[model samples]
Target: MTELLSLSRAARLAGVTRAEIQKRIRHGEMQTFEGQVAISDLLRVYPSVSLEQSGDFERVEQIKAEAYPRSHDEDTRLPSQQVLITRIKALAEALVQRVARVEALEQLLEEVRARLDEMAADAGDKSGASAAAETQTHTQAQALRDLSAWLQTRRTDLAESAVEAAQTQLLARDSFLRIMSASVKMIPSGHEFFVDGNESILEAAVRSGLRLSYGCASGNCGECKARLVSGEVYRLREHDYVLSEREKQMGYLLTCSHTAVTDLQLEAAEAHSPADLPEQEIQAQIRKLEPQSGGLMLLHVQTPRTNTLRFMAGQRARLRLADGPEQELPIASCPCNGRNLLFTLRQGDDAFSQAVFETVTPRQPVTLTGPYGDFVLADATEPAVFIALGDGIAPIKSLIEHAVSIDSIEAFHLYWSVPAPRMHDHQPWCRALRETLDNFAFTPLVDAACDDLLALLESDLEALPDNRYYIAGPGSAVQAVVSTLLAAGVPQARIASEELD
Candidate 1:
């Protein structure tokens, strides 16, 4: 029997994670003997693998130059065969990029069609098909038809792109043509992982057995927010969060929908305990229901005092309605009052939201579980910045209250973005707080629409650096503002995010 290398050795030799080695094995990209692999087989599978290539193309050139001393007969240092291989690898990368662009275009086109349909329906409802309205409707219908035709055109373009890709056919031996991955450096612990061309940061991290806070893996939940300390990244999917320009400038990102474009440095907010959270469902009751402006409800809930749940401020819990399925919501009350909890949920036609606002009367029986999340305060004296939108203001309140009453902080700033003055219920409270608390500043950002959210935070972003940031909102709203913050270069270590879905 031939001696074979273990999975550990293969991972080490190939400069990849153990999960990556196993994945390649499952795909039959790397051959194995018995349950182990041969060194020759490993090298054959990864001909151009390197130990985190930061400017390594030059290193390869320098190594080649040092091996073959300069000669008078040949001015070109690269051999014809090597040059051809290099060109092929570059072409492969270009093909991958084109495919990605095509996929993004297809998704965008779908969104455009949906939006146009929605606009057409809304317009018809409002205008009652008047002459001018009918003309507009006709134009919209024509645009929709044109869009359908454009989609087909794009499909043809994609086919052409595929044909182009097929011309530069690749072979297993040409592993150098494999797509490149961006290396990510996790601050504080300094652990490193590579985000493959198709892998999002959260996916890569979790796959590699690293623990970070995340929720709903889908774009709807803004749970996987991190700070892109440095380097470029590209969005892989539509994000629900709307980020302010200031937040974009600060470097916040939702790791579930974005992929690293270059060697990166990121900061992650992770759970305090390494072990998985043990969820225990228990009996609870609706203690109070305070109606806020618009379709928002401030629901107060309380579990049995005997079995109090422990969770960080800004953490979330699942609220089970009498006639509805369970809904995940952030606790508006801090952990100081664990058994007695307050929650904020939007009033909607859905069973859960409706139950909270109308059906579920005070003192009604309910089921509750959790105190789950890693959106607690950072252990720093730096100024804290909190941004809350719509019902997302719930968890931010818990954090803000904690900062004022429990923990000692250097300073803190709070920006509340709401649609109208009727929704500005907390203005007087926050203004009074500013007068009483020397370290606190509150800004009421009325009429702050999703697209222009960060405009209110411009001056604050310029003043705050390496300060703790906590954002709570609908996933899309959170993602948008977080992306802006990340683009603004906010260190990921100082940011924490959670979403109410």
Candidate 2:
């Protein structure tokens, strides 16, 4: 019997990103059966894969420790008791079925061996047989006995096969993982994310950088309603929003109130374009206002718990002060944390800048609206070149964080041009990123021109022609980088840019 593993599970067992597994499949290095990889094939490709090396056991222990006293607690890292029970029941049923099948196969094998023995005994009892015929019957009987022995030996070998044992361990860990968390696959868009801990489907979706349409993070609105295409989900909390009888019969569930009981396929609304996202107005409180070098201010704000802002990474938002001033700036934080938002602001003669720098304090209420701009990442699993000139790092920062959250980007190379003071402030971050992400590289330039930037990227052009390019800064700087990339044989469709000034 061959065990087929989902792409995500195969990646986990192989200790690589899912994108890496997909890349192998695309390059003909690995094969998939019905979008799932065979465990045998996985082992053949990733020979070094081991239970310990996969870190699955450690993860199990960690999640258990994190969710200790793991009953119905919603604040912990384990699913609710009801969800856990349902998953265990499902696994138990599957196990029983497999056991029954094994027993039936054993019985069939015994019957076949008995028939072979009968045939051999009958051949030997042919007393009237000629000498030549008797010799031929004896040879046939010997061959039949040998065949039976070979079949028994083969069965024993398979029962104790090292590959089979390894796969069994992998399956055990995977089952535990499934009980702890359920993977959600979105339809139409084909987006996928894991629902870990006790997080509702909506929460997990948002944390995974998915721009699913929702009116409220709470369960009061039915905007988060999605059809359960397959798999099981249990209600973690009751919702006030009532679904129609027809909708309920058709498997509709409120994502904000339900927890997945098994891996799920959901027909949910997701935003793939700027137009897909609706304009939202949120009254957010200032959380922190810290001044950094190069006259830049880091303004942090937290939205009301029930009404978080909905936006994609690398997008801009319009911030308005009560009876003061307003400004439109690129968000500097990833969309994973919709309630908590960060913006990079340069102190300028603008009224909004002055108000934010001098008057804004913690707890100040600000009206935020219009999550604008289409400057977001496009190929989630591609190597990317990010060019940030001056304050363009703001949006670029969000893009980088979003890519990190997605956990599928093959590689990241950032080329940032800023003043000496700004570069000094950015070095620690760049160094930290390099130290953490093995595939990340950074180049900081002080007062560099288009020619210098182009020269620095020449090697990358030769090495990564498929790399997606993102340029952000002053309009002129963005234009210069775009032209340089285009002149270097990069397709225009592969390049995206945003002007910060």
Candidate 3:
């Protein structure tokens, strides 16, 4: 028999009213295993609920069905939206408080320094009290050290708080702007507005129903790059090393990174269709997990639902592990046999990978939270070439499979490379693809034994009939290929790639 919880107990654990729990249960919206509600159901209804209660748990299938009859979906429930908005607001407010605290601490430090100066001045005037002066000096130095350490800590806190504030603001703003921009009218004669204040213009714009172009949303990818038509944008974080000074001077601002100090009018470089940005979540069972090579694992995930996942070939998903924290891993291969989803995991010596390989098990429930990334083959008309190194072949493989599935027999070539023949264990799949997919050619570049990878890329470019190129691989390899492509006269805009580092 399932251990049952009364409505009151479930409500208390869920941080909701007993009436609400009864209403949901009565409506048959929530599932109870043998008349006992699972703690997990409460969590789905109230994600922010404290995890202090311990017990066996059941999963809730549809909170909205029982809780809010008019709610569109469980994800769209007021509780979930409230959780997101409240958390975002709280984060923003906390950042402001931290900044204020840091400023106050700095002022106190200055005061302490001034007091020490006064003490030093008094000590200088006393000649006969030399011993007392020395003792006082030592005490003052120690005090100064303590104050300095405190100040440093405060500064660090302030820096961290600032980054948090910026990130929260960006997310909120992006969410708002993307929804807004979809329906807004654009003026034929572009209007310029300056971005002023620490408030996120993107968020404001999003809230106002404008969508903006952005990538990584972390300021690392320049996909959100925009020209500051006017006004100054003070960057809150110093991690945007990806953007060059010249780019900044050119008024190029990363919407995710820049806050407007002045009212700013900027144009979005990319526009996405409404259907392209649907929010989706996938539940899957861990079917198989095996070590493919050193530090890399081949993961086969199976979803029970027959709903087709319409994702672009090169797009990536956020994988929420059953045992470990979430990770963003690219779908390394295409969906095979219309049943299994495939991905490659290169175990970087991180806590995430260690948990996945060493601790996570098959039959575990994993959730995927995405279909993000515009690195796919967006235009069917454009003749394209694909390049990948090592496990970077994941996205390329997706694109190829998608292209073949759609009967797009356009001129497509794949150049895939691994360290050696031993690492080419998955090469049989590549050969199979080439054999089945007409108009598709594969070039396998093995290390040391063949012509240099870069040289081969250059030669391939020479023979290509004016086509766009997509490259994905390690940072250095991608850069080398991009440089070669750019030097070989391919337009920068036509050369699309993603650096996962």
Candidate 4:
């Protein structure tokens, strides 16, 4: 029998994204059986990945250290004791079933041996039986002996194969991952993510960049209610909203208050586009204001815990300071963390930008509303090119982060052009992204002309018509890039642009 692994687990074990695995399958480099890869195939394709020193396991650790250094505490790598015990019990039951099957096979083998011995004895009693019958009995006994020997040898081969050290270690690592995190598969949309630590299902979904519908994250409004289709869950908090008896009978639960105890499948609502998200007004507090290069300010704000902002990445939000007019600015942070949002503000003569740049202190109250824009990423698996110019890097940054969270894009190429004086400001970040993501490339252009930018894009991309393009910059620059792409036979529907001016 062939040992098979799910695509998600195979990707985790191989230390690559699921999209990378799918790409290989699409290119006929790898094979799958019913959406699962054979363990032998996985090992063959990712020979560099193993549990040995400096292998796939260590590569994963390195990525965690670099990309998500503050993701969780070291002590929290294990699941809760109760959940751990349940998993162990499940494993034990599977072991018991296998053992019973082995015993039954042994008994059947003993019976076959006894029957062969009886046949051999009958063959020797030639006086009472015909000569032809005796000859047939002896032949049957010899054939049975040979078959028994082959079965025993085959069983030994299977036993040795089952204990292959490298594959054994791979499976052990997968079990360890299960202990640390539980996978969740959303129904209808078929989206998936892992629930790390003891975070609620809603929290994990949002953190994974899936825009699941929700109102109050504290479970007061029951907007996060979902029917449990499979897996175990534990309530992390008590919710005041009572479920109908019929809903309760159907396993309805509040995702905001429940944490997954095992891999789960739930019928949950998700926002596929910006239009799916409702208009929300959140009174957030200014977390901090950090000055960046080229007269730009990084404004950090934290929304209330109960009411977090719900929006897609690369969208704009209207922010207003006390006694100041609202200013619409592109959000510079990933939608993964709606509670703590970031905005990139150019410190121009505008009142809102000046207030944020000069006088906005930490914990200052700010009115945040209107996650307004249609400049969100498409739900396609094609390669994407992101072009950001100067301060326009804000929205592009959010889009890149969101794409990384989803880990579904086939490839990504980022082109960032800033004035000569501010060229070095974002280089460090671009370098980090290049080091972390296997499918990402970054090119920096300092005060580049339109020809220079277009030349780089033409040289970097394999095909212009096949990939999606997203551009953010001054209105004139964005229009120029868009026109060039359209003239190059790129479809208008494959391009998305945001004017930063």
Candidate 5:
């Protein structure tokens, strides 16, 4: 039996009005028994609800001490757009040196040719009396040919070596920081990563093998959300995701969407080693495809039992078919059934997927490489909230099934949102989950209400302050929900997010 609290006590604990509490109940965000609210549920929804939001400077300071970042503003920026400028500068220098050498050699060659002409003319006039001059002219012509061959070789070498490390300093052509002029030094832990104006901080970190939680590598997924503790930063591109006003006040920005302007002293989740999930290159066969309501196809893949893939739930892999380029898609199946894999492919203009959907048939050869992504279930036993947008439901479904199978969780809620009400085709699986699990609930947010996911969530789940939120959606929608959570004062580490294409 779950513990229950009265509406007044719940409101008091959450520091909100009774009407607000009622709204949560009506939206199914709050669970109750005979009209009484669950205390655990209240705590899960309002981790910071007990903290006085009206406190003075000292109180706010105390809260800051307990949280991640110590400050928000007071920072500097980097020299933006250094990569392009660096390349141009390198090319210009190479061209200048090459041109100078070529011009000097041409002048020298012309002088040599003119002297030989004079020697030949003198030899012709003096006949037998100037044999020595004729011999000197032949020697000069031979030397000129040698010099011309040398110049040609040298020019080829210079052009070929122009883009290599010799021209661009020690860093090679593809080096992530090769063109960067500014460096970002993180505070407290002191891990440093370099960034050019063109690359986002997240991209630079990844290239440097420093992991800051990121997904989509676009502005829409707020997974790379971090505070600018004290560095000037500039936007690389306008982000698709919306940020809450509170979040902006807190100096939160997506590492994938911003570049450091100054030598940055930053505050972010410390870069850490990724989990060791053994990776392999395997050949699999396409088994089947089932059409779903959202113009999606449930793709089934099977590999030989001897070469069964090892992957955690909620992880994705890249698939390559025949000779086409590889396409990255999430694994939509549990490891419990290790030999077979499931993935959801949205029908659209993507040539790779369309090729597989329309032309490919069963038993066709496919290649898989991965078990990438760190969006799997956390080690904690906290109740979880899953919000899925469109085909983002794939991984969430994997998580739900696997979590239950592993006894990792029982009670969890899913908010499944689609483009419209007509695309709500996942009710059967949700019903099956409810029947199987001891505690499970699925809520579909479809129709026009699904159009603005942030607004829908803000109006419905604003009271949930503490549950571990696992969100997967288009980058913009994920960012919006994350911004909403951040504005509500949820801890950053508790919000796990990934971006869907």
Candidate 6:
């Protein structure tokens, strides 16, 4: 039996469109096994199939071709051949016309030379030839002037031809701009214009001096994604083959591919660059490093000089490990604790982890910088749901503690997930939640044994009665969870999620 691959993955591997892949499956050209198609079937029948082997090789080649086809000799040669044939035909016709014109000019020059030689022979036989010599000199001067005039006419024609060529190039450029401008719309909201209409949002924004949230602009990366409140968007190119049907229906546009058809209202949920963030350095002592279940370590750092280090909860800081270089990490603790700074670190016994455990003793000096990330607890009175996975628990933990301290949050729920072993080790944090929080619920998933987290929430969503949801996790996991939540009827406006990377 052949291993199955998703339709999107198969499309990527087969160098065909996802729509094409689906068509093939429907047409019985390829067979779908499980939620994916058999690689063998795709290899056997894909029109552009080059690789006999399976796995990601076919997709890799497709991507390379798309990115750099010019580097391939065969690809370069084909286009060059067509262009060469067209140029050769044009040059051949021009050369033939020039040759015929030159032949006619040569015959006319021969007639003039023959007439001059006859005149010279007549002058040679003259008895008093001074007057004849003067007449011949005048004739020769007249012929030289005629030749100069002819050369000037040819030069004028060449100049005119050069000007016409330049005008053609200018017109071509103008046409390109007009075509591109039609697909792009520029909207000015306040001092800054919100450019949402263009499919190439980043390119448009950058051209206009507006910075957008993007990591890899390629569609596969999902870095430049945005919610389109109202508009029709078309995808040009995508890096990743996966885009859920529900996301499309809900008007969630990947800014990379989304060109605006109608005027749009977009709420960008991305972090401001580090240059925009306030910079500060703080001295703190590592008071305790308690092991938490699920490979999470609860770090309590004491800053006695300052009762509280003013920083954002989801913001990260740099901790100079005792042996290794400084490690930059985000703050996990809620802002409620003034003097004691709390943070959580995911452990794997890596160099940084080893330095924290073996080298850095409690009460050791540590330097922290940040209150970074734009992920913050919104100042809304409405109840919200906080969903977190893996180390993503850090930000949710901060927001929750802050809400409880301010008495601003009336209702909220926290969902945290990690491996079973890590969960077991960090049971105390869960115990603390069970003991302290009255209105909140802490439901931790041992592993990703479940299909969807939002589905689990839907079973009791009505009970919580909160419309807002904040989510953070690894890029892929975050995308899966967000798609699942949106599919479950959560509005795009109500859902806030961030991928740290």
Specify the highest-lDDT model's number.
Answer: 2
Q: Clash number for model 4?
A: 0
- Segments of candidate 4 deviating more than 4 angstroms: 52-77, 101-144, 162-165
RMSD of 1: 28.5
The collision pairs in model 2 are none
Candidate 3 stretches greater than 4 Å from native: 1-275, 306-308, 335-339, 420-422, 448-451, 457-465
Off-target runs (Cα >4 Å) in candidate 5 are 1-274, 447-463
lDDT of 3 at 227: 73
lDDT of 2 at 445: 87
Local distance difference test scores for all models: 0.64, 0.81, 0.56, 0.81, 0.64, 0.55
For TM-score, candidate 5 versus 6, the one ahead is: 5
Q: Judged by lDDT relative to the true structure, which candidate is superior, 4 or 6? A: 4
RMSD (Cα, Å) for all candidates, in order, is 28.5, 3.8, 27.7, 3.2, 29.4, 27.1
True-vs-predicted CA distance for residue 289, candidate 1, Å: 1.6
Which candidate, 1 or 4, would have the higher lDDT against the true structure? Answer: 4
Model 1 per-residue lDDT at 153? 78
TM-score against native, each model: 0.44, 0.91, 0.43, 0.89, 0.44, 0.42
Which 10 residues in a row give candidate 6 its minimum summed lDDT?
Answer: 68-77
TM-score of 5: 0.44
Question: How much does candidate 6 score in TM-score?
Answer: 0.42
- Candidate 4 lDDT, tens digit per residue, 324-362? 856999988778878878887777887777777777799
lDDT of predicted model 4? 0.81
What would the per-residue lDDT of candidate 3 be over residues 174-232, giving only the tens digit for each residue? Answer: 33322222111222223222122232444333322233544344556566667766543
The 10 consecutive residues of candidate 4 with the worst lDDT sum are 65-74
For 287-310, candidate 1 gives per-residue lDDT tens digits of: 888887777777878766435455
Give candidate 6's root-mean-square deviation (CA, Å): 27.1
